[model samples]
Target chain A: MLNIAVIEDDKYYRKDIAGHLSRFGKVDEGKSLSDAITLFDARKYDIVFIDLNLSGKMEGLDVIKEAVKRKIPPIVITGYTSEKLVSRAYQLGCKHYYNKLDIQNSFEEQMAPFLRSLVYKQEDDIFSNSFVTRNNILIKNIKLVTEQMFLKNNKVFITGEKGVGKTTIAKFIHKFSTGSMDSFIHVDIPTLENNMIEPLLFGYKKGAFAGASDDFKGLIKQADKGTLFLDEISSLPPSLQKKIIKVVEDKQFYPLGSDQLIKSDFRFITSTNENVEGLIESERLRPDFYFMAKDVELIIPPLRERVEDVRPLVDHYINKSGTSLLVSNDSLKLLENYRWHDNVRELKKLIHSFCNCNTEMISLINLPEHVIENTIPSGQSTPLASVYTKGISNFIKKHGLKKLIETIEIESFKEFYEKNHFHYMNTLEELHISRTAGYRIKANIKKLDKERHLVH
Target chain B: MFTDKEKLLHDLNGNIVRLGSIFNILNKIENSKDQEISKNEMNQMLEDAEQTAILLNNDIKTFISINMNN
Candidate 1:
């Protein structure tokens, strides 16, 4: 049974929430922020319902932030909500923010399914398998390569850092390939013992060796008329790598202790987290094998390099987790700035760990200490700053540098005047310029403002 | 013209009543198994109710600010 928490300052509302939720699962009621915190710390709750203001104090938002950090998805039910407050709630990571006046009816109709999803989803398989991205050029290129490669039956060579979704993409290509069925077989090269590698890849005849008492069909034969995905291809023995290249070239291999050549038709999809050049130079990977494997080479970019995919991925994971908790913009900004060494796999685990926190929203405060420690702060040259820079660059491209500089000067002067409440002396003092220059800048700002008004 | 405290209070009470009745309608819609209201229509209704609640809340906040300053 799911454990749920309801935190509201209003006694009547608190009871109402508890009563409604109790029908679905165990309900823990809190009439204050302190109660909510204490209850949350005592045991794990699947979901938390929160109010922005509790007893005339907005400290409840803090409690919500904390809960979201812990991964407990929270729904905010409050009578006091404005455009600013709603946006703030989402930015802080609340799953759903509701006006208490409409919440009673909406809760049963809309929120029950959301609540059920949070508590009942047992697997992470619901997330969309297709690439989730905005404008990561590398991801777009890789996708184009996948589409290009899918047209032919050529062996695919995928390379990326561990957890960069190499296997996922391989599987996607397999499914997308024409005539794909239940015939997709995956073999982890590193897991097999050195002695078993040959026998596993190329079957063995009955009494092939002391342990080979019966005939065994290998992974290659099993993958006949389908796709064979070799994960961690870097771990394949050098001897076997040479042999497999021949089999891929001719689609024929001899079983152990047998003279008969086995002919099989299988599409090859191989992936590795190792640097191929380094492996080949070290003699761990045969050069001939590498040549045969690179029929269509696709490199999956690491998470940090593909930052555009993070927001959509976060949304995908959140939705797949079946939780109502919203991710705050601040948290997303931090996530985007983070160097995800483990890539999408690490991100999936991180989201899973925090989704258990019972809160209205996931805030920066809810983020992992390591993630928070590694992130670039807001005051720095952020991702948003780059977007603004691009916008400015576009303007400069369309217009000219001189016009851009003039506009910047006017805008800066206007900002300074506004900051000082239109006090000329204060603006001059801050700008460290003469009164005349300050007056001239102010006059320019007024003209620009008038022009802007006319354009609007 | 600025509304007097008495008029503001009256308006707030009326808004609350109106909001309560809307809630009642919403409750009936939710409880009915054969809900003829389309999802988009229901969403529109909810959005409308939320806007009214927000306007009322803003007015109350304005009144509180005014009284506090006074």
Candidate 2:
């Protein structure tokens, strides 16, 4: 039975709801908004039936707002059926709006469907397929594709930048594959570089190598009837790549220091940050292997494109790290606007730093000066303009010169100097400046540095 | 502010207790299988399981809401 809370000011209607709902489950009754809040805090209620027309200093809308703030969906039971109130109730996150006049008959009917929808909605909202993290639209898209691939027997090739979530995606595919979960095996090809490929793919007898002490089962044999995720597939040497192709296509490989051939069946999943097509063009990657694995190639997008997902990704990192670091809105805005060149790995490191600082909130002051300083044009020129102005002020404070006298016109010179720090000569060879002005500026900077040092 | 860890632990304990009670009832019914059990007994076992499941579901929902909000 669902634990329910009935919040109504009217004595008769409140009694009626409690009496009716008690038949379904345990019912907690509250006469006022404060009482409702207290009951909600004290107990875990599945559904909250709140009267929108509560008579008192406290309004029912306040209770609804509190519930919404707590991320709990409230059901509004009101005598007032105004369109304004209904729309407002929805805005306040009320999942069900019911007229109290028909509480006896229609209440259960309305609540039945609402509760069912709530369960499904909660599940959908929690585990959304469209959810992106750290602007990594590629990972989100890969997640969806991998889910689809899990149901079918298909070759999936994951490619992305190094330290991108390629390995994570490969593991996700293994975990979610339709095949038995225990059958999935992750094999790092780079680790097999020193060993003979055949022995790694097929089980080796004792003393197969100089130091072979015991017989070993290969990854392909162990991954039979499941997935064998090959990480850093590009690192496989040409000879190993050809052997891998043969194993993938012919389903057979010979063990090292042996002549007998062994057969095994396993689905192949490969990951590489490098461009396999480029490797094939360079004749480093075998054409047969590339063609065999080219059926479902998923190119993971970099993190810069999907800046909107940074907050939740940061939250996820913070949660996983068990850190109580709260990211301030402004600081989060800075993070979201940054061009995360290193993708999720870099963002995770930032979170680690924030956690290590042990600050309650990650403010702009706590962030690395460069991160806060380099706010990319987040499509909002006004904010960037303000930041630029602030940066110029800081620069001016550091450099105590009103303006540098230069050969170029003063107005254009100031703009160029403020923007590019007199680097126009580097960009344009003929853009001349007075040597005396440059010397004067250099002398002023040295003087300012000396003064700063003395003050510190 | 209550930490999410505390709330989750409290909810988990409550669910474990509820599920344990249902399991006990199921165990009792299985033990008494040799003696023809009445329909009412079977119905009670099913009802207990259903109630426990609902309680567990409610606890899970609460835990999720608390964690997400935090």
Candidate 3:
């Protein structure tokens, strides 16, 4: 049975909902905002039904926000039906919104099926794909895509930060889709050239353009019966976005300079690190295309937010490497503390780098200087260092040890001059350097600024 | 003071819907005469919706005050 919470200020409405929902789950009631929050932290809830207005305040929004942080979706059962209210509810991670008048009917149709689907999706046992994540929300969404999108042959739009496994999820969807053995073509939007994007994607007949000497096949034709994952689709030019929408709708397109139309059936899965709504608001993406692509949307949380997955991911990567090297607790703690800016991809890279250590165990001493620099030490008052030594280390790695010596000297000379309030003679004498050498150091420091801003 | 007419509409819409729901419950209890709902519970639901309406009314008044420059 589901553990459901009803957070409606109306005791009558609360009792009504709780009374009905009790048949499906263990029902809890929260008559006020503080009561709702207290009940929420008391246990893990399978679902929460929240009113948009509670106790004469917009406290329901706060409850929804808190639920989203815990990776649980809140179902809005407010009486309000305004577009703006509905939009805010969805933005705050509500999957369903029901107006109050039709509560009994909605429960019979929408709510019961939804709960059964959640149960059905979990018990399917289809998470053996390589997109390994222990996050409950990610697992739930993956199950949803497999059960809904793949079975229905619908499109899925994924949104997440870079390296957070959006593409991996797309591939996992393809593996379970109808044409599982067919091609899985990945099209990266940023790599498309402005002048050649059209011909590159839709192919070209002989003599279509000046350089089009031979017939060419494109991305769409390549994925004849399988999946086509469009990465960072918001970067696609608006004109091209419109054309792709037609191809998606009709499943038929003409190659450049060809009168005949070609048909290709392909499953569509698109992803972007950028905000889709923001892109549409700015008129960068067509609303029609957004509607077509967003049949089922899945969002992956960044690795930093789901830190519990770090140890399992590390172990998985290590076991996959065909070697058994244990991670020392100190090293593991540092790894856990370090903010993984690049998500799972960065973690994989860290593990890949560890293989070169040739040591039996990964210890504190074997960790990279930059990784150690980013990690926060326990029980320490000082924040992660603003001046990370990682930049200096990267500079040495990119340039050489020689450049490191020059950079240190330049910094030393500049520090002396600034400390002496730009008295050139006094500062140069204090550093025991000639005026000419000091001038050279000053020029070198200026050159360094022109080259790049180090020490981020 | 409300800068966004859209947001003000949303706040008003929420309260209006609450009042609508309260009225519907009151009507159901009156017409059916079989609702097991408590009379005190119905009174508090109405009171809660009224408080929301009053808050939204003040918001609209503030919006008018700012616009009229009174």
Query: Relative to the unseen true structure, what is the C-alpha lDDT of residue A263 in candidate 2, on a scale of 0 to 100?
Result: 82
Ordered by DockQ, highest first, the candidates read: 3, 1, 2
Candidate 1 lDDT, A1-456, residue by residue in tens: 356788876554565556567555557888787898898888677778888767657766887787887888888876554566777788888888876666565677766776656533511121234554454465456545554554445678899999888877777666544223338889988898989988988999999988998999988999997788889887898888888988988999899999998998888888889888888999888889888888888888888777788998888778788887688998998898776757898788778766766566778877765565445444544322332444777867865787666656665665677789778798879978898887777787678556533522
Order of candidate numbers by lDDT, starting with the best: 3, 1, 2
- Please tell me which model should have the higher lDDT, number 1 or number 2: 1
**Docking class for candidate 2:** incorrect
**Candidate 2 lDDT by residue in tens digits, A336-383:** 887565677778888987787787888877786546544565664332
Residue B58 of candidate 1: its Cα lDDT? 82
lDDT of 3 at B70: 48
* CAPRI band for model 3: incorrect
Query: What is the lDDT of every predicted structure here?
Result: 0.72, 0.66, 0.75
Q: Cα RMSD (Å) per model?
A: 27.4, 20.5, 20.1
Off by over 4 Å in 3: A1-126, A129-131, A376-456, B1-70
Provide backbone clash counts, one per model: 23, 1, 0
Overall local distance difference test of candidate 1: 0.72
